[model samples]
Target: MAQQTASPDDSNGPESLYILGPFMFLGIVFFIVRIYTRLALSYKLNVSDYTNAVAVLAATITFGLFITAIVHGFGHHSFYITPEDSVIIFKCLYVVLTVGLFAAVFARISLACLCLQFTTSTVPKIILRAQIIFQIASLIATAVVTWIQCRPISAFWEAVPGGECFSPPQSWAFTATGIASDLVCAVIPILVISKLSRSLVERCLVCFLMAMSLFATAAGVLKIIYSYRFDRDPSDALRDMMPLFLWCRMEEVLLIIACEAPFLKSSIERVLRRMGLPVFQQKTKDLNSIHTFPDPRGSQGEAVKKDKGMKIDERKLEACEYTTSEDSTQSDESDGNSTRQQHGEVTDSSQSQPMSTPMDDV
Candidate 1:
């Protein structure tokens, strides 16, 4: 539970800052690491990286607005703040909410773009493309409605004697839309990634990262609940709305972190390996690499003849080592040989292709 204020002058301003500042810093740290990992692994930045960049930038701006609001008497009751400072708080909140909405939308788009790299099927691609369009459209409508809820616009943050305004349904609708989109973004990965031909461990890792959207959805739900509370007793708006502010910020930054988490796996593994920590050994071969086998049903002592090897495209094998380490083939060769022998066949390890996984784009 949030700490309650004892009087109009008593506020949770400092507590809110303490909570939000570290999260914003952590989100920026992940963004820098994501960029660094891609460049270090010899991979170029793609659409997903660029979209997440915009999301993080928007989140940074929203955090700044949050700080500005807090400093201008945002957490105090109406009576404790001067009219001028109250107006400034309202103005900061308006921009904060609007920019935060974009941050979430772009984060969803970035995740969708990352999902696109893992799939090549027509139906899944179409679904992902549709999701992107729906998110972009919703963002535009919500932003426009938010600003136009009051006839004079400035009435949102100040007292306008003759201004007309809409009811609170816009806020409710925005929250519902955010929650619904987040659920879809979270579910799409599970459905699509489960059907991938990768090892069970690898598929589960990617799906777990993608499913982190549920955390953002949970935050959105909390925001709505707190919003209802604020609506009922708006006399102390700054105090009552503190939870709403915190939950909204959480939803935005969590989505961004979720989008970047999968990309950071390689860097994390590298760090662990450098620290002499034991990571999960890849005991399976790269599905995208070529493997040759020899027919074991030959005459005794006859020279072994290799069967035709599966031809792999050279371009497809040029992925980052995070997806498939070149050293994995050498380590797992014995396991491969034993498996083939159980199936009454022999593999030619000398003809194995350089390790490269299909999920490198992830």
Candidate 2:
């Protein structure tokens, strides 16, 4: 709770910073893994990847501002904050709103670009175009509301005798639009997957993967709900609205992660196998296998005898077939014995065609 019209004497408390820890830690880890998988493992990252990187950067700034605001009395009861401290916190809040809005917009745009990777259809392309246009429009609207919400802009930090400002309703409407955009982005992917001719389990799996965007949607909604406290008290608004600010950063971080997860199917399976869980076990064929033919100058009788005695063992080449990662053939320990046996057997036969590595990037 805030004290009524306090003097500018001192700042206090870091409770808000402590509250932001888990969300920041998890978001950073997810972003790092997604980047490593997209760049190191998948080998072809798109615009979505770059945009999400920017979003993560923006979210990190917002996270810092949350901590900065706390140091200036954000998490403290208003009595501890002076009028001078209130001014500083207000400036921090402005930065948070400006950067937080960008983080959300960039993340959704990244998600929109992600959807473009899947569909080559004309209709879906048009729908994606429409989504992009809406995104641009929403971005402009949010920016307008943010910068102009208070007249004589500095009035936002320190109230002016003659300055006028709009109510929170316009801001609420913009926040609501952001939350709706998150929901739409999430639902569109699920709807697209639902139309594919896939089994129930596969469809459910895809839908659930796409539905990870719901976490962002839920975060956006909560951000709006908590932001209502903004009008509660100017001196302590930053402390009171900490939950809203925290969720705002979380929305972008989670969206970046959830959007990239589907493409990391191979990477995730590789990790699971390393952890000793049976997953993506491949049965590879000895494509480097040899087929000895009778020498042009050799006798037919000798060739027949060699052919009659030589029989290829029925080995499971599982290691080579479904091992989608390029590094998997050498990195997989379980496949070591099979790979060695396959190579030794090939030595006993005549070298046929050179083997080619088979793989499909998801």
Candidate 3:
């Protein structure tokens, strides 16, 4: 990729900053809406559902803070010009690092929530526990790396005029850890959901939700790639890319919210209905009423009786038994009559036995 230099004038420029503001605003709104929806479904949902909501909230806050820091850093440059400007930039970088750490933690929790829905076996549970542990470790590592990225925290924002700063390796390690976590979270859902017992439609829906994790993975990759270039030149272009970083963070949080949307389908539909959208209302009502069974002995009893009568008659059983017995007796008598004739024929050879022969047979 070709490297583009970001002009100082572009820092907090009207256009770039303006566009990011609305997106950040919408992200905050979405996060609040998601929290409210989760609370509504809390009675029906499991612990994981609430956990996913919290994860999204954490990720949102992280991104929101990072965006604020970017705006602050860039906004400062809008009026002043000096090597000390790097100080403001580094402060923003610290905020980004802090947010990145939180984002990692939140992503892992969100993945755990997804895993809970599909897991039934002990092995999966163990794997989930391990993932959570690793996530915590990753968070701690990130925090430590960020703090050490700039020696003497005060030097991060105010130039000492001659002190040597640490290399970008610290930032690299932090970014690499986040990328690894994102990949883990993305792939874990595929494995877990694949083993779930669900209809094709249900499976597809879940797969789609799982697919949203790819956005996070993409963000991770972008962050890593951009971090590499930023490491080389840590310039204004890298700084302006803050919007992309904010987007990367926002994508993860939004995806977490999206994954949980199914749990709020009923509530969403209800809200839609109240707004006078008839189709959603009817569909939601229909789904809600599905478990209700009609009483056959009540209003539909006559219809049931009519259908049953068509397949069965009251006297058929009685007539069938009598006719079967009569047929059997007639068949026995015919056999007896034939045997008498045959005996008469045999008697002629045995010197004439009367045709009537006594009832006992000759």
lDDT (Cα, 0-100) at 237 in candidate 3:
43
Off by more than 4 A, model 3: 1-8, 12-34, 44-89, 168-177, 187-199, 232-244, 247-264, 267-362
Please give, for residues 1-362, the per-residue lDDT of candidate 1 as tens digits: 12334453777877987887787787899889889877877568988989999999999999989888888888877667888998899899989988998898899899888877766678878878898998898888888888888889888788899987676576787778778877876787788778765657667877888888898899889888887776523567776788889889988998998888877667655777899976533344433222222432232223222324444343432221122333544556755432233333334453344355535544
In model 2, the worst 10-residue window by lDDT is 343-352
TM-score, structure 3 vs. true: 0.59
Clashing pairs in 3: none
For model 2, residues 1-362, the per-residue Cα lDDT tens digits are 33344445433334445545676676677777777777775687778888878878888888787777777777565666678988888798889888887777787788778776656567866877687788778778878887887888998888798887676466677667667766766777777766554445545665676667888888777877777656654545545666666676677667766766565556666777799976642233332333222232222222223444654432432222333344654554344323233322212222222232111233
Candidate number of the best lDDT: 1
Each model's lDDT comes to 0.74, 0.64, 0.51
Predicted model with the maximum TM-score: 1
What are the clash counts of all predictions, listed in order? 0, 10, 0
Evaluated at residue 124, the lDDT of candidate 2 is 69
Would you list the clashing residue pairs of candidate 2?
A: 7-82, 8-82, 8-83, 282-318, 282-319, 283-317, 283-318, 284-317, 284-318, 284-321
Please identify model 1 stretches exceeding 4 Å from their true place. Answer: 1-8, 195-201, 275-351
lDDT of 3 by residue, 150-205 (tens): 56666666656654457546556655655565565556656755554433444455
